[model samples]
Target: MDKLEAKNRIAELVQLLNKYGHEYYVLDQPSVPDAEYDQKMQELQRLEAKFPALVSTASPTQRVGGEPLDKFQKVEHHVPMLSLGNAFNEADLRAFDRRVTQLAAEPVVYICELKIDGLAIALTYENGTFVRGSTRGDGRVGEDITSNLRTIRSIPLTIQEKRSIEVRGEAFMPHHSFLALNKGREEKGEMVFANPRNAAAGSLRQLDPKVAASRNLDIFLFGYGKWEADSLPSHSERLKYLAALGFKINPEWKRCTTIDEVIEYVSYWSTERPNLSYEIDGIVIKVDDLQQQEKLGFTAKNPRWAIAYKFPATEAVTKLRTIELSVGRTGVVTPTAILDPVQIAGSTVQRASLHNEDLIKEMDIRIGDTVVLKKAGDIIPKVVRVIEEKRTGDEVEFSMPKQCPSCNSELAHLEDEVALRCLNPNCPAQLKEGLIHFVSRDAMNIDGLGEKVIEQLFQAKLIKTIADLYRLKKEELLKLDRMGEKSVQNILNAIEASKSNSLEKLLFGLGIRHIGAKAAQTLAAHFHTMDELCEATYEDFIAIDEIGEKMADSIVQFFSEEKVIELLQHLSTMDVNMTYLGPTQSQMTAIFSNQTIVLTGKMESFTRSEAKKLVEANGGSVTSSVSKNTDIVIAGEAAGSKYKKAQELNIPIWDEQKFKEAIES
Candidate 1:
């Protein structure tokens, strides 16, 4: 066929195949037989290969496209993927309803949906074509997994919606797919995933789109984010319209006019959950009206407009095989119960935290006893109670060990603290655990330096301190068992990259007593630099609203140590960033402070999210459209309606150059 004819054929085939796929995957109906679909797909592949330029990202053949990615890029969410609050029982649901009613000063409608037990993702489309997809990482930032997401049949490459849009959804592995994956992994002598949720999450994180496709991942669009001219009055209509746009909307969602109906929906799902094909751990209840949702607004963490009624943790009786202990970064030794493998809440319950000796004594938990095991919050495994009736006379009581498991150091039970800790500063386990925490996702986020690599490094005596990580040489790393040249290069690059992370990461990575992530953030924002923080007194810390006496004292103590001061200096010489990368106290009220800005058209240097972050960090807010209230419009090349609206409204307009200069100034 000629190129022109092939192009027309490709377009025709693309539309036809997409229609068939939507019917088969999303609607659970097939317009054509398998043979016919296969025939048309084969024809499309041949035509595309003949006219290579005709092969497009949206082509049916490109679902599992290209080579595996070396690494995933970070994407900041335009609209933060805020989490919903929880309602455990009938009273909690009623309380939520009362709050909504009180705020609206009228009866409010609500939409209830099954909270799919899977990973949350946001998909962005421009001109009705899918462009990017990402995980809901820390609400504001996420890993870009657009290639993996494209492999999911339920997600359309193109939609009927002509305008740009962002949609949030749950990506999940169906029960059958989960079973098949586990069976395949077991056959291959690989570690099988514990549950479908874990399986889904792992699959999406794969560097290869083919691997993600093999897992048969699916998604259900839950809601839209930052859409232009969103005039839909209610959430239910929005869902229906999204479904009409060839998106997969879960059929289980319901619109309720009263709280009683919402309660009924939750109650029915509680029992009927077992009958569903996929896993759903809870029912999500959201205010139906868009106006009501806006009126309710949000908390610092979660949206006040929605609540999740989490399902009760499933219980299983299993014999406690043994007890094991592990040391954390702070030297706190934790005891875990190893039990006979038994299924609970869709995952195998083989281990649970016994907490400390006090809990063990209070509950009288013993090995060789048939104990009742339940996952805490349906996530962490925990021993709820002892099945005393099922316990035999031969059951042995568990005792806390006196010596550290890794270093064989004497353990100390700190005053007023329940956890037995290894107070020895030089304990190997503490150092090893500290190294792991330092590179963890929420800390420095050195992606390749996982627990196994840290342990390997510790065992080899090649690294000892957090500073030693920055000192790692490629030649030495290549000496390790699994470290190939490429792997070692990536690790070194990641380590070097982490040196420039914002101050909050390093503060949290330090593992200071009584200072958790939030406190670390507070300290970072207040101190602005490590030098400033090092000189802070307990009084200085206590002056902050959230910093309690204990946390303040811990912060003061941590920075006062000569060893820590030396380490910071050493890291600084290695070119690590010491100053705060976020908004400083002085810059908080800069030129853009308290202004509402709108972005339009194509950006040359930074992405829309990147620009938004810049504006927000310096105390400006980014809104969707230009209006009389809009303080400035950051117009880029091919600036569209928003730019025109800014001119019409007599709002200030700035090119990217001016916006950059003003922010920098």
Candidate 2:
């Protein structure tokens, strides 16, 4: 075939493959065999190879395309996609009901639906055509994944309504599909996906849209990201609207008038969940009324209008073969229960964390005892309960060791805390863990230094302390496997670049016990330099609001350590910047102090983000859309529904030029 004809043929085949994929994955139905799909894909690959320039990211053959990304980019969410508060039992459900009644007063109804075990995504449509989709990254933001989402068969490429809307939902791989895929992988000697949720997440993260398409993914629309237009009256009505507009809504949804009804729905699903084609961990209960939802509002990281009623803990009985202890970087000894291989929550379970000595003692867990294990939140397997009747007399009870497992240092127990800790300054395990934490993304954000790389570096004896990482040479790095000259240079460059990071990064990088990123930032902003921070007394640190006595003591104790002092000196010698950037010593200034502004639609003159920056620069806070609280709403051309919402809210609205003029004025 000629170049043009081959391109046309490839497009046709991609459409055919996508259709088959949708049928197989989304609908749980197949129109063609795997052999047929593979045949078409291979044919497309051949054409693409022959005409390399014609190769596109959306091509069917390009799923799982390119190498794995070094890092996921930060995407600020258009509207904060807050998580739902969890309701563990009927009492919790009743408490939620009480809270809703206190807030809404009059008769209230709840939208009860199956809580799908999958990755959450936000889908944005413009002029009834799907344009963008993103992962619920940090709730405030998510990764842009428009291409990957387009591959899902259940996600309509175009809606009949010619209006913009943002819909949020769970993208899932059904249990049956997951099993079939895993079976195929097992036959091919490839690594099987741990669970359906994992399979869906991994598939969606693929860089190539074609690879994502091949995975036969599906979605069930649940909520709106930022609703455009006010046509839908209630939450239930919106779901119906989405369904009418060609989006798939889970059929298991129900409208519950009382907490008892919600509990009934949850209980029914707890047993029925296992028998379903797709995996559902719990039932999601949300307020059905849109106006009530608005009045109910949200908390810091969760919505007050909705809550997830999780099913009773799913547990699998497994034999505890042995007990082992691992000494962490902080010299905390955590006992692990080595178990006979079993499956629980869709993954093979071999070991479970015993957490600390108290947990082991509380449960009286012994080697050779039959224990019930579970994976909570789909990660971290833990022993839930012991089947004492199943335990043989030969079972051996374990005790917490007096000495550190790694360095043989004496362990010490603290007040209020359960875990015994090794306070030894020279503990090797603590040093290694400290090094790992120091180089972690939220700390120094040094690229190419993951857990595996840290382990290898420690084993190679190239890094003895956090300071040793700064001293690593490019030539030495090149000696490691998979480390080409370019890779080596990248690592070296990243390490060098880390030296110039903000004081907050360095403060967090120090890995002081009980001090998190936010605490570190606050401390750094309070003290201009590391030297000032180190010299500050516990009382001085505690004087700051939010810096409690415990945190102050931890900070004082950490800075007072001779080894930490030496480490800091070494870092200083390595030419690390230890000073402030944003506000200097003299400035008693607060820039961008509270003024409310709302942003709407696409802008031609300036990007939405850029406009927000301009607003912040002149002391104004830019919100997602308009409301009564909005001091001003910056509306660009084709602002659509948010523009209308602004009008309804009676918020002051301005065009792009007027917004610019106002900012300057």
> Each prediction's Cα lDDT score?
0.86, 0.79
Cand. 1 TM to true fold: 0.66
Kindly list the per-residue Cα lDDT of model 2 for residues 527-602, writing each as its tens digit: 8799999889989998987599889999999898898899899989999989865443244232335768878765
Clashes of each: 0, 4
Candidate 2 Cα misplacement greater than 4 A, ranges: 1-22, 31-112, 122-131, 134-143, 154-168, 175-216, 222-264, 285-308, 312-316, 341-350, 373-384, 409-424, 484-487, 502-508, 511-566, 580-665
Candidate 2 TM-score versus the reference? 0.66
Error of 2 at 591 (Å): 11
* Clashing pairs for predicted structure model 2, backbone only: 63-211, 77-140, 77-141, 329-430
| Model 1 agreement with the true structure over 285-326: per-residue lDDT tens digits | 999889888899885446778888888887788889899999
